[model samples]
Each structure stands twice: as C-alpha cells, then as structure tokens.
Target chain A: MKEIATYVERTFESVPDSQRKSEIMQEIIERLEDSAGKLEQDGKAREDAINKAIVDFGNLDEILQELRGQETGKGKALSSLWFAVIGSLLVIALTVFINLYYSPGVVWFLYPTFAVIWWPLCIFFFGKWRKGR
Target chain B: MVSSDLLRGHLETILLRLIGETDRYGYELFSEIDGRAGGRLVVKEATLYAVLQRLERQGYITSYQGDVSGGSKRRYYHMTPLGKANLEQGIREWHEAQEIINIFLRGNIQ
Candidate 1:
C-alpha cells in the first residue's frame, strides 16, 4: 500500500496544478487500496494484488486532455482580460495626453468619446462570454 | 452480454445515474457500478475518475469532501440539475440512435 501510494504521489506530482494533482492522487491511492483489499480477501498475495492493480491502472490520456483543456481555457481568459484592461487604459491615456498637450478644447469630450468607442466593445465581449458560457 | 461500445455507453449511463442518486466517493461509486453491472463491466479506477472530473467540469456534477472518522476523507460527487436534464436528453438520443441501428440491422433500412 505504501508502495502504491508512493507511486501515485510521484505520478500526480508530475502533473501541474498542485491542488488538483494532489486531489487526483489521493483518490487514486484510495481506490487502489480498496481494490487491493478486495483482492487480498479473495486469497491473492499482497504483492500480486498490488502488481496487478498497478499494471491494470488503465490510460491517463483523458486526464491529460482535461488538464490541457483547463489550462488553455484559463490562459485564454486571462489573456483576454489583460488585453481588455490594457486596451481601455491605453485609449483613456492617449485621449488624456492629446487633450493636455495637443488640444485643450477637446478635454470635455475625451471620456465621452472613449465611452462611445469602448462601451460597444466591452458589451460585445461580455455578450460573447455570456453566450459561450 | 454487451459489445465494448455498448458497454461503454452503459458505463456513461451508470455514472450519470449514480450521481443522480446521491453524492458518492470515487471508490464507493466504483463499487456501485461494479455491483450494478453484475460482473459484466468493470470500470477501471483511472477511467472512472477521469470521466467524473469531466462530468463535473461540464456542469453535470459537483464534488465535495466528506469525513469518515476511521477512514480517509472521501471526495463525494453529486449530480447537478443540469446533469439530470442532460442525462434525460442523452437517454432519449441514445434510444433514438439505437432504434435506427436496430432497424438497419433488421433489414428495415428501406
């Protein structure tokens, strides 16, 4: 059992995302132990049960795929959020710079113009996000 | 008594159905499927969990940890309302597909 737990811990730590890796590893250890216990009661040798259970542990592609999907989704969301914030800040900053240095008269319209151009984009992205979810 | 593909379908159904019942830990869920399948289908530990995580992320299920004093704490999974509705829709679609397959195999394709 300790061997099995060690094996699982190593396998899980190999995965990124510490929280999920530990959670998954813990579950795997629990299940393997339960199966091993059953096999032992059925007269199988402890070593035999552990070896067979480990060998028959099945594929891990699905788990990898799930992790990949999550990573991509989070990366995309973060990038988009950063892009929007930077883009909005840039637009406001550029407008303020222009009003202060180039044309003092248009200062009153800077925020309103920024709103006119940025609000639609914000609304559109929000709508897309809501629809996607 | 089921082809591997058919067996896989049943596994999906069993997972959804079990979650529909109550939140169960992974090992406990495995036992339920094993018992219910009556030795016809045995779900691998890894495969079962991968599917559970997928279902949870898809909004079909949610999980929490429950303490068992003498034993290790277990992570429990429960079906969401969306899961129930999705299962119903899936069952209907599967039945329709199966009917079409049966009809074609029975020479009623014309």
Candidate 2:
C-alpha cells in the first residue's frame, strides 16, 4: 500500500492544504488498499493486485480539478466579501469627506454610513449561512 | 461500455439508492456499483468521489469511521432522510423521463 499512499500524495500535491484535503487523501488511500486487498484474496499476487488497483482507480486529474475548483470557489466568495467591505469603506470615506468638507455642522454622513455598512454585513451573514448549509 | 456522459447525470441517484440500501464504505460502494453494472459501466474513481463529496455537502449523506478486521478503519457512508427523499424524487423524474423518451423513440409524436 506504500505505492498507493505515494500515488495519492503525488496526486493531491497540488491541492491547497486543508483539513478536508487530508481527510480525502486518507480516504482514497484506504479505499485503494481495500480494493487491492480484495484482489489479493481473489488469488492475485500482491504486486499484481496493487498494480491493478491503481490502474482501476482511474485518473486523478479530474478529482484534482474538482477539489481545486471547490477551493477556488471558497476563495472567490471570501475575496468578494473583502471587496464589498473595501468598497463600502471607500464609499463611507467619500461620504465623510463630502460631509466634513461641505457641511461639518449638520453631520449627515451617519445616514449613508449606516446604509453602506449593511453591504458587507449582508455578505458576511450570507456567507455564514451558505457555509452552514 | 456505456458512455460516462450518459451515466453522469444519474450517478447521484444511483449512489444514493445504493447507500440507502445499507451503509457502505468507499470500496464496497465502488465494487457494488461495478458489480451491479455488470461491466457495462465504468465509473471512474474520481467521479465517484466527486459525487460523494457533493452529496455529502448537500446534506444527502453522512459518513463515519468504522472498525474493520485488520485493525484499520474505513469510512462508511449512510444516507440521510434528505437523501432518501431526493432518491424518491429522482426515481419519479427518471420514470417521467423514460416515458417521454420512449414516446419519442416509438414515433408517437401525437
């Protein structure tokens, strides 16, 4: 099963480090091992069983692409939230500048600031709900 | 061999039905699929895992580590109520699709 372990490791080498990645790797290795064991029980030699198991496991690239896509999806969501936050901050900054520069006495920036704050808050809560789902 | 493209869409339902039958580990599930397909279908390992992960993420199934004979643990997957409901719905849809396709195939365009 050393070969199987090595194959799984090499296949997952490019996957971003995550707890889920490690768990998946372990699961794949165990599955391959189990398959090879079954083949050995069916009268195949250890080496032949291992080789056949690996061959039957099929391409890993497809799996890698999926895992990478999932990670990228998560990263995209987080980056979008950050973008919203930065955008809201910039908007608030502009409002503050306009208020301070034009009419600091009235102080009407708080209304826009309150409205802008909700953008990131909505995204943050949506993200949390999505993750929980 | 059956084209994977044809089987891809129904793979989720098939797996859910299998898991619904009983809790199965990865190897057992793969082997069962292969055996049931009778060598007519070739399910790639990557495809199976991808579907499994997707189903898990969708709350259709849950997994746990199970003790095996060799002092090793295997991850077994069990279907949830949501999965069972989905499976039933899939079966209904499949039957509807089959009937519609059969009508077309049979040249009963009316």
Candidate 3:
C-alpha cells in the first residue's frame, strides 16, 4: 500500500493541478489494488503481489509528458487572457487611486465599473459571436 | 518473451483491436493485454496512458467515467469510428508488410 501510494504521489508530482492529479492517482491506485488483489487470490502473498503490481504497472513519465502538454496547450491561451485582465485591472486601480487622491471622488466609480464590468461582457459576447460564426 | 520494445510499435494496433470488441476500463485494458500475451508483454502504464492520450487527441478514442459498484470511478475508453477505420488501414498495411517479410524470411528473396 505504502509502495503504491508513494509511487502514485511521486508520479503525480510532475503532473499539475491537485484535482486532476488526485483523480489520476486515485484511478491508478484503484487499478493497482484490483490487480494486486487478483494476484493475492491467485496464491501470491499480499506484499509480493502489491510489489509485483507496481512493477508491472510501469512508470508514469510518459503520462506526465502528455499531461504537461495538455497543461501548456490550454495554459498558453488562458495565460494571455489573464495577463490582459491583470494589466487592465492594475491601470484601472492606478487611475482610481489618482482620482481618489487628487479630486476626492466625483465619477471615479466609472473607472472600476467599466474596467471590471463592461470589458468582460464585451469579451463574453464577442466570444459567443465568434463561436456563432 | 516478447520485449516491450517490440510491443511498443504495435500498441496502437493492439489497442484498436481490443477496444474494437468492447469498451474497456484502464485496469482491465492492461490486464487483457497481459493475459492475451501470456504474460510476456507487460505494458508500462505510462506508455499505455500516453497512447490513450494520443488516441483521444487524434479522435480515435473517447473516454468516460464508469460508476462501478465501489465508489471509485474508472475511466473507460471506447474506440471511435475513426479509430476503427484507422485500424482497418493498419491491418491492411501490416498484412502487406507481413507478406514481404515472410518472403524474405523464407529465403525466397534476398
């Protein structure tokens, strides 16, 4: 059990995201347990069967490579979106800070409102429009 | 014993043939391979997973979660129609290659 658990943990360490990593590790553990269980039923000792199962299951490096590919493929697109969002938000905050500091509030709310609100709505509708196309 | 290195080249064909019969969960998939090969071809889990990922990417297979009796959810993979077509093509090519190899092996060709 410890052997398989350690193996799973180590293999998944290269994989990103706790949720996906955990699910994969769990799937692997279930498979390992089942294989080892059948082996035990076939007359092998519990520990030996488990050890053999781990050996037979082989490594996760290739899986990790594929997972990393998936990570980057999606991450690249989302990361750019995040960069734009963060950059705009910082500029909006700076403008708001200047407005609050210099003029002591007249229409500073407009800066944050347009920055946070209308921008996302436009992106959403624009994305939907592109999809429709 | 057949080396896994030899088996690696045929993994896609092997999977297509197996999954063509029925949808298979990850565990049983490997077990069946081991069973069919008479324990001579023990596939590395990572290698099989990589193949599965590639098949899914190429639209050759699709996977879904299986709600088994136990709470554990298993990922079940089924071949796509495209996968069947691909397998058919692979089989044809293999047969042609096999014929040529057989001729060479039989000393009919240099």
The list of candidate 1 runs beyond 4 A from truth reads: A73-133, B107-110
Error of 3 at A84 (Å): 21
lDDT of 3 by residue, A1-133 (tens): 6777887887677676755457667877877887888899999998999989888777777777776776675456555566667766787788778888888857675757575755545655665676578
Interface RMSD of each: 1.5, 1.9, 1.6
Q: Write the per-residue lDDT of candidate 2 for residues A4-92, one digit (tens) a residue.
A: 89989988998998876888888788878888999999999999999898888887776677677775778899999999999999999
- Write the residue-wise lDDT of candidate 2 on B1-110 in tens digits: 98999878999999999999999887678889889889788897867888888888778999887887566677789999999999999999999999998877976557
Best by lDDT: 2
Clashing pairs for model 2 are none
**Per-residue lDDT of B33 in model 1:** 72
After TM-score superposition, the amount by which residue B10's alpha carbon in candidate 3 deviates from its true location, in angstroms, is: 1.2
TM match of model 2 to true structure: 0.70
Going through the candidates in order, their DockQ values are 0.46, 0.39, 0.45
Give the 10-residue window scoring lowest on summed lDDT in candidate 3 chain B.
B101-110
Which one wins on TM-score?
A: 2
C-alpha lDDT of residue B3 in model 3: 71
Q: RMSD for all candidates, in order, please.
A: 6.9, 6.6, 11.0
TM-score for chain B of all predictions: 0.83, 0.92, 0.89
Worst 10 residues of 2 chain B by lDDT: B65-74
